[model samples]
Target: MNFYKDLEPIRRPIKDVLAEQKLFTNFPDNWHVVVADIVNSTQAVKTGKHDDVNLIAAGSLIAAINAAKPFNTEIAYFFGGDGGTVIVPDEIVNKILSGLNAHKINSLKNFSLELRVGSITIGEIIKAGHELKVAKVEIGKGYNKSVVIGNGLKYAENIIKDNYLQDKESIEHQLLTIDSSELNLEGLECRWDRIKPLTSSLEVVCLLIEAVNFKNQSTVYRDVMIKLDEIYGEADKRHPITMNRLQLLTTFLKFKKEMMVRYSKWKIGHFLKAFFETLIGRLYFKYNWKVNDLKGQEYLEQVIAFSDTLTIDGRINTIVSGTKENRLRLLEYLNQQEQKGLLIFGHFVSTESIMTCYIENRNDKHIHFLDGSNGGYTEAAKELKPKLQML
Candidate 1:
């Protein structure tokens, strides 16, 4: 009369039970999990630097996995020379993908290494692990390259769920479109009129908004205001040939001044304002703070052109000749853009003479940058992805 007697018999063999016990013990239930491995391990070993390569490979894997953990996924097990296993809760699958993508980008940027990620739901692993052996096969397949195994998941799902998901191609396309649209607006405006089209000035305004949003210190705001005033004073000294153009520049400066004053009263304004000031300060130091120099003036022009092509929250790594004159020019260009409303963050590392800059609209999410001799722009960006969501 027992209900158990009416149920169908279990089909899994004894060995399967034992294996499942070994792998699935302590594994969380109702979660989606991913396991990743570095490809070409043997090749890295054959190069006679096996120990170093292994350490790096292991470090990269750990970093990538940890990066994903914040989204509610946990590393269940690590099988060195094989791969790692992750368990993700059903409710947080979208979060897990975002963390994974950010980790992938960071790993690529930091180590110049690529990853192949494979993910499977816990339910599938529990059900199919006994019959189809999907978990074992997929985990084994990911050894040298990155691949994901979940059937129902789509790229769009990842994008919608993860705010930090940065698609380089997509970002580039958007930037181009923003610039084109802005340029078209300029064409419709009277060329003889003094005021420039608003489109060209959006970045500057965005920066002001961001500065107001992220800055936290009153002193920082005060300092930024001083710097802004100095920039305006210099512009006044130049005295453009056309009164309309001069008026336009003055009006823009006045707008920023008012925005800065309002920004200082907000809770986060100090931090954002400070960051902007620091960015401008760094650029100034790189250029020796020579605002009136002609070369400095030209550098500012190039920065504007470059700014038009940048994605909000994008980073750029470039090496320019490191000279007092060159740095001064860079500062001038950056300050001009700042006045125009572009939020720019940049620094120059002396050891490598690398000028790394992160530029974005003020309201756009914050993207981090790493400044140093080696190339780690991707890694910095990857790490920043999660932080960007906090915005």
Candidate 2:
């Protein structure tokens, strides 16, 4: 089913679907689920390489999409802070894996991060006795993000990690000898500087929560969102991204490096072109240039609109900007929820958050990604694992 069209009918929060069990449908058995996350991401984040970690994670999505060549085929993807998950037909799994291998290699050579990439089949997930149910969440007009609402993907992630731990040969053997010279990463950009909260005393919190029961997970998540509103106001009000906060870097080194990430290498002419483009970007941010019916202000709003700030992919995860007091209030609420057997939660707070953009256009096709500057989601995910495993 087409996610864009099908998700239009789903107007309620996913909690309704989880309660009814009718909104999610089984994925085709021939399809494969691909997951990639940076190994030792915690260390990298601690070492002050969080942006590289995020780029690698976003790059994984680019790798799979480029390799699959799914011009008209339907694909589903979810971006975690450290990496992401992509679902594609088995017919293109090998190609996608090879592209992932290229990404893994590039990440190591360029940024010194080891991206662990692997895939598993729907049959294997079913045989493991965990359900895999898929649905789409509509975020904007004709825009949506696919969500998986069962333990099957979580199981696959664990198995893949186990394989990475035990079978180095098989993992290495899966790396193909294909040429990735023409890597496709058309929509990704990181022009904006880090975003500090509106108030100096505020903090950026990244968190993940999983309920003890799948049946109650959505309800618990809805409560958490409600609590956020009560404390921090609407999602837009809590968002850290804004036009005044946007800044374009003019450093030649950063310009060259960013260009190289998209292109294998560049000539003098390419460098000059990129330099001019960077200037134009600065001008646009400064002058509020309209791109496809959206000024800088409207564009920043769309950036927040399409972000994965709060998401539910087998578990609820969020990267929010708020005051320290509000953050503590939410934590206390979470502890109370944990006490009541509603959910178990983990969170880490940082002084500032970073944004990365993937603008297919300034219109609804654009999406922004955010993570706390120093050890954001990686640290939160680490704290979450022990609790998630116990469930």
Among all candidates shown, the one with the greatest lDDT: 2
TM-score of each: 0.26, 0.90
lDDT of 1 by residue, 46-110 (tens): 45432223223333234334444444333332222212344445555544444444444443444
What TM-score does candidate 2 get on C-alpha atoms?
A: 0.90
Candidate 2, 106: how far from true, in Å? 1.2
Supply the TM-score for candidate 1: 0.26
Residue 3 local lDDT, model 1: 16
* Backbone clash numbers for all candidates listed: 29, 0
Stretches of model 2 off by over 4 angstroms after superposition? 1-9, 12-20, 68-70, 173-176, 264-270, 291-293, 389-391
Can you write out model 2's per-residue Cα lDDT over 1-391, one digit (the tens) per residue?
Answer: 2432334345565545545566778887877889999898888888988888887787778767666555445577777889988877777777777777777876776677888988899889988787777777666765676767777777888898898889877766655554656366666677667777777877788988887776555566667777888898777778766556666666766655556555545557867866787788677667889876778667666666787686677787788887888888888888998888778888888887776666666667776778887878888988887887786
